[model samples]
Target chain A: MDQFLQLIVAGLATGAIYALAAIGFTLVWQTSQTINFAQGEFVMLPAILVLTAAHLGLPMGVAFIVGSVAFVLLFGFGFKRFLVEPMQRHGVLPLAIATMALSVLIKEAAKNGFSAEAQPFPSLVPDGSVSVLGAAVSVRDIAIFVVAIAAILGLQAFITHTRTGRTMQATAQNPTVARILGVPVERMILLTFLINAALALIASYLISPVYLAKFSNGETIGLAAFIAAIVGGFNQIRGALAGGFLIGLIDNLAAAYVSSAYRTAVPLVVLVVVILVKPEGLLGRKEERTV
Target chain B: MLFKTMAAAIALTAAMTVSAVAGTVKLIDVIELSGPGAPAGTNWKNGSDLAVAEINAKGGILGQQIELIHYDSQTNPGATRAAVQRAVDEDAYVVLGPIFSGPISASMQITQRAGVPQIVGGEAAAFTRQGNNYIFRTSLNQADSMPKLANYLRDEVKAKSVAVVWINNDFGKGGRDSMIPELQKRGIQVAADIATESGQADFAADAIKVKNANADAVFVYLNEEESARFLRAARQQGIAKPIIGETTLLGAKVIELAGEAANGVKGHVGLLVDAPKPTLVEFGKKYAAKYGFTSDHNGIKGYTAVYTVKAITERIGKLDREAFAKALHGARIDVAQEPGILIDTKWTATGDVDRESFLIEIVNGKPVVKATLPMINP
Candidate 1:
């Protein structure tokens, strides 16, 4: 029972990271109707940026701020203005393809421009363990779980209650109608991209300490988050969060009980089953035939 | 008389030009410089350059200046194959790396076919078993090192059941494969055997499983970075079992990254800086003076490999590729013959090397040598 509790807590903590990463990926797809394939690279950029800044003799806080400004301008505003906007004209698929190209380009740039060696990140949470039901759970894991739940709550409150969030949702649903209703549709879309960039930075800061920061980390985290978004439902923020936790929990349980080599296979099999059975995902909204 | 004298002067100048141009011998270095292997690859590259510089300063190898050219393997097997082909195409006298077993396996066949000697730093058990006569290793392969490690597990630790957590790559898989049978031979029970991916982030589950297995000791077979993550995770989970691994786990990078977590972990070190040898002590100091950071096992591998080539060439009395390969079938290059060889190293017919290695424990973030195991052949 003690061992089981440890696995559960660890699994949930892993899920929290996936949940945070999934939100960013889902946010971009929700507003732009295009999945930013480089969602994982966005998570990597901030960690590298901070590392570079620290190497150049800047304080950690200052380096983080510098990294934030750079990430927002380059990924949020510039990405939507240049890559997504230009590519969205052809089709959503083309925009997705462009994001993938951006992922490859960013990966190479990070590998060559920065160091390829992995470095331990300066974690926000204190380094210690907390005994939860005799499991001795890491303090970092609790922080990550709290942050993920908070993000989900914040998303619900903002989209339902706030003016700008409603406007952003209106634009995602129908840009033509939103623009006719005197909404600045382009600005709202840019806001979504900016929100995604912020989420990526947060995810990087949290996960880097556990995983270590390196150039190639995007593939593992990025692919998992992409799957989480699909499993949770692309249309709903809460679904994405739930999807992240589900994948993390499944991954941990599978590895603990089954063979570690086949641990990754279990989540994938669940994803396939979800796709075959639900088509709209476990929490995805089904299209009504009323029209 | 004037016509004959002018012709003689022209002939003299032509002969002098030929001597000047022909006084160079080229060796191509194919190493992982830009990818996952960068950490180990960079150290090997630096050590190779240091040896080249030292040899050139002492009037060159066999009186010809060493022309060392480097090509990036990108830590990919295909890239390594391409790099080796490029080296062969350029008519290199030798090829120096692609340290990872996967890349070295992809590349060694090219050098074998080309009849060019290639010295590698890969330590997988299957490294020298592929019938490639021209390829040689500068360190102990898993086949030789695992038995020593198993002995340590049996004699030193007195552990009956040992769990093995290994990476699922060429290097890690080979180590795990070699270790299991060796443990069986020594009557040690195999506990939880867990396989992990390269660059995998989360290890809490792995830690939980290893702890739950209740094994007497844990054998971690992974790259340096992954080992550090595992070390920290194990410590965080309060795993107090004696964890053992090869040089990769006990290496400088793993120690630095693992910090307080790496303390007291035991491993069989093949080529480390703290081997309790005067030559190694000197080499480590010199390497630090030249390169700022401490030299890891890869650096020692790269440094000794250069001297092996020079010593073999000198013993053969010529630089013929075929002769050099033939002479190295059963060659012993002692430190007396070449101080740069560092220790007495013997090469088998299949290109595997036998040398002195150390059993070490990481104490306070340093590799403290516990015992020196002499050459198996000796």
Candidate 2:
């Protein structure tokens, strides 16, 4: 049915955003063995910064690039260096708590510095809809889907083909052994954070136009992405991507077909079912530790 | 020696009475002045502040200067509760706000227990139904407003089939509950009833469902940001049905956020800055000059609340909580603060004001008044 097709298109577009956000979480977790609870804050920060830059008279394109790069250095690099690096030596719990604190700090800072009112962010694509297979789809939605898919594919290629990417993967697998084998484990971890931050900015740029850029949006996007990562496979990038799409699809389908009142509960249900059935997640490999 | 001691005791008692008579009457405002709700909260504060300033300049209430003490709720219920306790501890003559419904509901218990008169502008119908005598709402309740909205949809817009999309909160649910039955009464079929989370960004799924239902009009009940987002999403998905929304969509935030996409959407608005009334125009100009921005419905409600309290206090000639509550319970006073918007400020037994609701359509990024719906009891 045309209605079903419409829901599918919308679902795919929404899923792409979740996929990018989940990728941000999975990347940091894989490299550092620590979940960046603030991954959602990263999605909000760059969009707000870019909006601020644009308001300050910078060209939109220039503002986007500058905002993304500045936030990566300040928050991404600064967080890893100042908060994560120091607390990581103590324990994973401390590091995770630090990330949670970082998220709150970022959210509060944005609320105070920027207006609490949700501001309109300019879309990358033009404003219009096209009939695709009898379902009307917004140009922005299509652009988001294409861009997100391309970014994921590009990341896949980078990990498979590049020496630095392979070295980063090796570091993620076993930092101690990777370091002993001459891999720069510290640098790889930092690079992973940078990548995660970049991915978050990309997702923000895609989604902000639809959602409107607000400081509180971080929690909504962050929680969904966290759920996606956990449900897909917290340690696997591909699994996280698949999990993100699954959530996006289910959320939309549930709202369309079932009760919209229970749409928000769908993701939590998936998370609970996944946790109960397979603690390692659908695609996660069980850890084999030697005593 | 006995006569001298008796005279001294009388003198001390006389001094205490004189000091009490000359003391300033303090009104406490427990409202969100920070966090996400800050913009509206600031407007409310400014409105009340302006009213107090004007009242003091003319002459103090009952010859005693009025002092307003504002405690930030920070959009949290715990903070609101703490603020209410602070107001009680300060021995405030009356308390003004906690703008959002949830905070107002949470703080109502404290105010009721303390027996402090609390006047709120939140639109939740449940705020009045709690059987609390001290709680008064100055804004239009959904019970009174939504039926008029449904009437407009039936008579003016002439839509037969309607799709209802509302945020799943007290305010939204109240609107939805009141609206559905009203529509049914008029023989308008509700094709789809969709509930959305507050602050939800993506509305494609919801929009798609509404589109699929193929209703003549879509009625939306959401906050400012969510309304803007939904409007944008719906328009983008090529759903061109007539969209009728609650007052939240007619706000400046919705215009700024939704841009051109907001055009053609009609809704019920409590206050319009461009209303052709001389008093309202003057108030708008004064408010803009003072606050450095245009005032919204919240500001108007806040401004009117102060005058309402002033009216009550002037009638009683003192700050007696019980007397003030009794006076406000079915009293009608002509609100002089913002005349046209909230003119005949009549309170029902349940403390809801009998105020007119105006219909507005967004045109060229501004709300243009279409029709005025007189207050009708639900």
Candidate 3:
């Protein structure tokens, strides 16, 4: 029973990371109607940048801020403006392909600029394990869970209550109508990219200590988040969050009970089952389209 | 007329001496220079570079300057094959790397068919076991080392049941296979044998399984980063059983990444940086000065590989690959000239080096040598 509880807690902590990354993916897809395949690379960029800054003798807080600002300016503004926006006119397929290319470009650039070696990230919370209900849990894991949940709740509130947030949602729903209503649809899409970038940065900072910041880490995290978004329904933010948690839980629990050899395959199996059984996902709504 | 004839003869002798001094013996190094294996590959290159510098400084190998040609395998098997073919095409006197098992295995047919002597740093026992006469290993094969490790766990640690978690690659799989038989031979129960992907970050499920199994010790065979991740996860899950790991887990990178969780973890190491050997000490200091980081086992193995080549070439008194391979078959290096990194300092007929395995435990985020095991015959 303790083992069961431990697995669940571990799953949730891991799920929190996936949830944050999934939310970022869902946000960009909803706002621009184009998938940002490089969403995972965005998460990696901040961690690498912050690690580089910290190595250059900057304070941790200052390095983190610089990393966040750099991510926003480069990926959010520079990437969206020059690459994504130009391809947007060509269609969603082209834009998505461009993002895929961008993912490779970012990965190679990071490898060349930094190193292929995994760089250790300092733990944000103090190092130590706390026993909870017969299970030992790291304090950092708890901090990650709390921060991820808080960020999700804050995002939910902003989407529901804030003017700019609602305007962003309006643009996502019907860009043509939103633009006609003076919502500045282009700016809203860019703002969505900025918000997603910030979310990715937060996830990277939280998880780097566990995984170690590496050039290729983005691909693993990104693939999981991508599957999470699909499983939760791409249209809804809360659904994506729930989907992320489900993946984390299923992945951990399956690996524990079943064979660890098939741990990586467990999530994919769940994805296939979800796609076949519930095409709309657990929390996604079924909407009819006029032909 | 006699004076002119003597002057011509002297001029001819001087010209011949100058030509002999200027002639070059080319060696090819095929290694992964850019990818997942780059860190270790870079160290391998540095080791060879240091050896080449030292050899040339001491009046060259057989009076001919050694010219090293390097090819980046890019961590691809296909690229490694091409590099080996290129080495054969260039007629390199000897070929030095392709450190990972996959690349080495992939390019073995090319090197063997081309009749070029290839010295490798890969630890896969199967590399030399395949009846390839020309291939030689500078590192201890898992087949030979893992038994010693199992014996240590059984006799010294008194472990009865052990759980094994390994990466699902050639190195990890080979290590797991090698360890299981030895553990079984000692009547130790195999609690659980789990294999995970190479760069997997989450080890919660694996750790939980090990904890539930309640094994006396855990044997791990993941590369440095994944090893750290597993250690962190295991410690978090409160699995406090003594963890016995593969040599890859004892590096500075693993220690840094695993932090306090790495404490008390014991493993087999090829080269312990803290070992009180003058050769290793001097090599470590020189490596730090050149690379700005302490040399690990890979760097040491790579350095030793060049010396092995130098030893063989010097013995045979030529740059012929066939003769070099034959000499390496029964060659032995004196510990006085070379570092005592390899135990017996000799190669078996199969081209695998006979080396003693060293045990190390992580104390305060650094590997401290515990004991040097009795030499295991190849």
Candidate 2, residues B202-252: lDDT per residue as tens digits? 888888888889999999888777788888888878888999987777776
DockQ of 2: 0.58
Instruction: List candidate 1 segments past 4 Å from native.
Output: A287-291, B1-22
lDDT per residue as tens, model 3, B56-134: 8987788877888789998778899999999877777788997888789999889898778899988877778889989
lDDT scores of the candidates, listed in order: 0.85, 0.83, 0.82
Cα-based TM-score, every candidate? 0.92, 0.91, 0.92
Q: Sort the predicted structures by TM-score, highest score first.
A: 3, 1, 2
The deviation in Å at residue B139 for candidate 3 is 1.2
What RMSD, rounded to one decimal, does every model reach?
A: 5.3, 4.1, 5.7
Name the TM-score of candidate 3.
0.92
Model 3's CAPRI class is medium
lDDT of 1 at B68: 87
**Residues A1-291, model 2: lDDT tens digits:** 988887887888888999999998888878767888888888988899998888789999999888888998987798789988899889788899999998899998898898666789987688778998877877777888899999999998888799999998898899999999999889888988888877888899899999988888888789888888888898898988988898888889998888777877988999999999988777877766665
Q: What is the lDDT of residue B303 in candidate 3?
A: 83
Give the Å error, residue B14, model 1: 21
Each prediction's number of clashing residue pairs: 0, 0, 0
Error of 1 at A122 (Å): 2.2
Q: Identify the leading candidate in terms of lDDT.
A: 1
